[model samples]
Target: MNATGEGEAAPRQIEVLASVRGRVMCMDSAYDVDEANRGRDVCVNSSYCGVLPARFIAEHRPRAAIGMDCGVGPEGSAIAGLWYLEALGIPAAVADVMTAHLGDGVHLYHHGIVSFANQPALDCGVTAGMAVREAAALLLEHDPVAAAASEITNRTVMETTPDGRSVVAADSIAFGTSEDTDRNVLVTAGHTGRSAVPYLRRCRPFGFICSDGGRGLNDSGMAGLYLVEADGLAGATVDARRARMGSGLSHYHDGIISAVNALAAAAGVEIGMACPQAAHHLLHRRPPTASPVP
Candidate 1:
C-alpha cells in the first residue's frame, strides 16, 4: 500500500514513495540512475545488477543506498556495486534473490528490506532479511553526514601462470606504476572505468583483466570502456557478476572480450572468448596452451 498501489499489484514508475530530512526513499521501475535519485534516502532499485551502481554515489554523493543484488551470479559481479559503495564509505545494501524486483521482496514498497549489506551498512546496523523500511529506519538513526574512509588498496601479484608471465591483481589501477619487475599480465577487481585508462597507459600491461562491476545504470558503458579504446593493450573484463574476490583476485573469471588490440588479434584472440585462452595466445612465451597455438 505505497503511493503507487498495494503490494503485488503496483505499477512501475519513478515515484517518491517516502521522503524525510532531505533523505528520501524512491523507486524506479527500471533502475536507480543518479540523475533520477539525487536526494533519495533509500533507492528501491528494480534493476538486477550492481556493476557500476556506485558511480552515482561518487558523483551526486547520496547519503545511503539500497538495491537488488541480482543474485550475484557467475563471478559475484552483480554485488560488486555494494562492494564499491562500501569501499567509497557509503552504507549500501541489496535485496536477496527471493525478494528483489519491483514487487518481489519483503514488501520494500511498504516495509523496509534487509538483504546483503556492505561492511559500512552492517556497521550501521543494516542486516539481511530486514525490511527496507526497517533498514531505512536504521539509516535514519545514524548521522546524516557522510564519513571519509581509506582509499582502495593497490593491486597485488597473486601468482604466475606457470608459463613465466606474471599475474598482477589489485583493487585499483595503480599497478602500472610498479617498479618491481617485468611481467606482462595484470588483473584487478576494479571496474574498467574510463578514468583508469590514463594511469594504465602510463603503467602498461600487455594483457589486462578487470571487473565489469554489474554494469548498473550509471556504469553501462564505463567499465573497461576506455581502456579498450586505447591501442596495443590486450584486455578482458570478468563479468562483475562473476568477479567476486573475497579471498583476493585469484578467483577472477577467465573470460576475455571479443574486442582486443592488434597484437592480441594477430596472436589469435577473438570476441566473447575466454581471457586465459586470449592471454595464452598473446603472452604465452615458454609453455604452450592446451592445444598449442600454431
Candidate 2:
C-alpha cells in the first residue's frame, strides 16, 4: 500500500487519444496545441488552467480550450490558468479530476465533468457540472482570439554524472529527443499517463521521472511508469501535491517521489525519496537493454 493507503494497481494501457470535429479538436496534452489546431476549439489533458500551460494554449489561439482541473491545488493554482485565458477573450474550462483520466483528452471529452469555467467560458454557456462534450460544443460557438506571443523557454540541465550523463528538466516529455536514448535522465512535469508511453519508448532515456498528477481516477495518472518498467527503463513519479504541476524545475527540486517502477526501485528509488536523490541513482545506473518500441 502507498502512504495514502491505496494499493499500487496495474497501469492501464492507452493510445494518444485525439479527435477532430470540423473546427474543434480534442487531444491528450497541451504540447499538442500547435499551428494545426490554431483557430480551432480544443480540449487537452494538461492540468486545467495551469499558468504556463494556459500561456502555451493561448499562443495557439484556439477559439476555446478545456483541460483537467488538477484537483485545484494550493491557493487554486491549478485552475488559475483559466484567468489567463479569460483575459485573452478565449473561453476555457477544466474537467473534474475525479471524472476523467488526467492526461487523456479523448477520455476527458467523452467522460469528463466540468468543474470550473472562467468568466469567458461562462459567458459561452459553460458551467460547473456540465459534461465536457457539451461544454466543448459551447466553446465552439465562440470565435478565436488573437494568439498570444509565444514565450522562449529552455529545458534545464539539472545535473550531470561523472561519465557525462545529464539530468534534464523539461516541462513535457514531448521535448524528449533521439539523443536522450541511453544517454540522459529526463525529469518532466507532465503526468505519467499511457499517452506518455510512446515518448519513453521512443527516446529510451536511461531513466525518467514525471508527475503523478494527484493520482487521479484509479491512479491512471501514473500509468505510463509501469509500461516503461516492462521495457526495463527506470521510472518514477513525483507527488503532485509536493510541487507545482507543469514545471519540471519544480519536479526536480521540490518534488517527493510518490511511486517507483520496479526498474527504478532496483536503482535505489523509493517512494518518499527526494526527487534529486532519485535522479542521482538513475543517472549512475547502467542503461537497460533496448526493448522493442510498441
Candidate 3:
C-alpha cells in the first residue's frame, strides 16, 4: 500500500477484535507473535508491506484471516497479508478498498467485503464484495483460537461537559456495557453502519466521534445517521488513517469531520469540522437521554 490517501501510521501491536466460543479475532500490523498471542488463529492485519514483519505469522499462524489490500498500490505489492497467508496454507483475504484503510487496518474489516482471497478462502466461497461478517463466519467455520488481553481496550475520559456528560474514547461499541451505557459523549473508532447499530445501541451514548473507515460517502457512511435515530445521539466521523484500533477512539482528538446526522446538526455536530472542534460544539447542546427501545 502506497502512502497515498492515508495520514496516520498503523498500530505496531495486535489487539482483540472479537471473542466468541473461546476463539478470538485479533487486529494488528506486523510483529513477533509471542506467547501472549499464542492461540489467536483469527487475525485482521494493518501492514501494507508485510514481507518483513509478517514472518511472525509462520510461527503463530492464524487458520483464517482478513486484511487491507492497500488499494493494490505500488505495482500491487502492498497486499502483504494475502501473499504471506497463502504460502502458510491458511484461508486469507484482503480488502480492495483504499490505502488509508490499510493503516490501522482493522477499519478495512468494517468497511470492506472480500476483494481477493487465497486458494483456501476461495474454496470456502469467499468472493469480492461479500460482506465482512459473512467472510468471518466462513473463517470461524474453518478454524479457531484464543489469546490473552494485550492490554485493556484503549479508551479515555477526554473532557467532562459543563452539563456532566462524560466524553470518552473507545475503539468499538462492544465496550458499551450496561454499567456505563448511557448519556456519554464517545470518541470512538467504529464505523457508521446499520449492521453496527445493534452494537451502538448497546453503548447508547449521547454523542459519538467515529472513524469513516476510509469509505465515508453517500449511503456507505450513513451508519451514524441511523445510529442517531436510535436516540438522537449526536455523531460524527473521522478517517481511518487518523485513528487505529482503540487509538482511533483516543488517538485522534482532532481531525476532519466526514459526516453527520440531522440531530447532530441540531446538536452542533457538523460535517467537515475537525473532531476536537466538533466535540467542543456538541458539549453545549447536551440533551437528556431519551429511552430507546433497542
lDDT of each: 0.56, 0.79, 0.61
lDDT of 1 by residue, 1-294 (tens): 543575554443334444464444445432434644554455555544465656654465566677666667875687777777766666777776555445432254455456678767776788777877677666655643354432334345555656556666665555455542235666665666676677667777656666565555766524554445444566655555444533124334444453444445556767676655655554653322245568
Clashing pairs in 2: 48-68, 49-81
TM-score of each: 0.41, 0.51, 0.48
Better of 1 and 3 by TM-score: 3
Error of 1 at 9 (Å): 11
TM-score result, candidate 2: 0.51
**RMSD list, candidates in order:** 11.3, 17.6, 14.9
Cα lDDT tens digits, model 3, 1-294, are 323545654444445445552243535554534444444445666554345545665567655666666666664576665667666666677766652355554565555566777656765667777865567667656542222333334556777867576667765666655544656767777677665677667777767777776755665754655555656566777765555534544435645777776667777777677777777666556575557978
Sort all candidates by lDDT, best to worst: 2, 3, 1
Q: 39, model 3: CA deviation in Å?
A: 16
The residue-level lDDT of candidate 2 at 73 comes to 94
Q: Pairing residues by index, what is the TM-score of model 3?
A: 0.48
